[model samples]
Target: MELEVRNLSVSRGGVPVLEGLSFRLAPGRALILRGPNGIGKTTLLRTVAGLQPPLSGEVGLDREAMAYAAHADGIKATLTVAENLSFWAQVFGTGDITPAIDGFALDELRNRPAGGLSAGQKRRLGLARLLVTGRPVWVLDEPTVSLDVDAVAMFGAAVRRHLATGGMALIATHIDLGLDEAEVMDVGPFKAKPPKVEDFDEVFL
Candidate 1:
């Protein structure tokens, strides 16, 4: 599977987040998106996932090839970890999450409601959903957020395994994910934001 971003631009409330950012990924490879806070990392990831629109560019993916894990855990707070996995698996038509859950050592938390799980556990559950997706191209946003060092290491191992099996991932993270020979795309050079106090926040006040 292949994914290419062509001159992608993103703007919110007339504020430009990304400009002319572009890249390509081939099968069995991974790319890491790097930038400081509020530098459009989440915005770009959302654009790739089709969750949001690109302000002035396009995102193209090969036919039948895509998946995403958002910065915020996509797991439903009301559902148990297992239930969430089951729902996504049936919807996406792929492997069950029990194996993934076991890999992440999440089996014990499977019966717990997502809302009751800790932050790290929720992220793990989010990762588990990807195993259910079974898509060739994956876009992950801050995938290790809220995870401890060891859990982060575990997630990296999972990503390596996926790539070894010919799957590709686009990961946005402040910490290294330990992927094999991953290319680093520096988005920091694109930061274009003013401090909140620099905004006109008194329009109606």
Candidate 2:
């Protein structure tokens, strides 16, 4: 499977953020999207995931081949950890959430409400959604933001396993994912040099 973008351009608040940006990724490879804060890394991923519309671009994905988990928790506070995974799995037409619950080492928290979990626990629950969804292209925004050292390692290992299984991922993060074959894409220079206040009405939909 391959994901292709051509002459991609995005503008928020009437100011262009990304212009003429393009890239392609295939199965079994992980692409690390590295950049300083606010260089449109998340915006790029969001566009690919159809979470936002690009000003002008083409995000040609085998639609069924992708799933996205952004910086947001993506977990329902009132639901139990297991309930969250079950909800995602069912939504994606996957068989069950049990396997993902096991994969993310979330067995112990399965019975606990998501709101009661720690930051790391919540992130894991969000990551677990990817496994249960069974999609090939993972568009992740800061998948390891709040994890401790061990949790970070666990997240890295899980991502590695996904790559081994022919799944591709595009991750936007400030930390190294510890994947040997990871291709690093420097998005630093591509960012708008200085952060500017943009109007919400024109920035996002």
- On lDDT, the candidate that comes out on top is 2
Report lDDT (Cα) of residue 166, candidate 1. 92
> Per-residue lDDT of 1-205 in model 1, one digit per residue for the tens?
5788898888766678878888988777899999888788988887787777778878887435778888666678899888889998899987477777876889888789899998888888888787878888888888887899889888988888888899889988878776758888999876655436544766445
Please identify model 2 stretches exceeding 4 Å from their true place. 192-205
Candidate 1 segments exceeding 4 Å error: 62-64, 191-205
How many residue pairs clash (N, CA or C atoms closer than 3 angstroms) in each of the candidate models, in the order given?
Answer: 0, 2
TM-score of each predicted structure versus truth:
0.85, 0.89
At residue 67, candidate 2 shows an lDDT of 91
lDDT of 1 at 115: 93
lDDT at position 144, candidate 1: 85
- The per-residue C-alpha lDDT of model 2 at residue 154 equals 83
Error of 2 at 148 (Å): 1.1
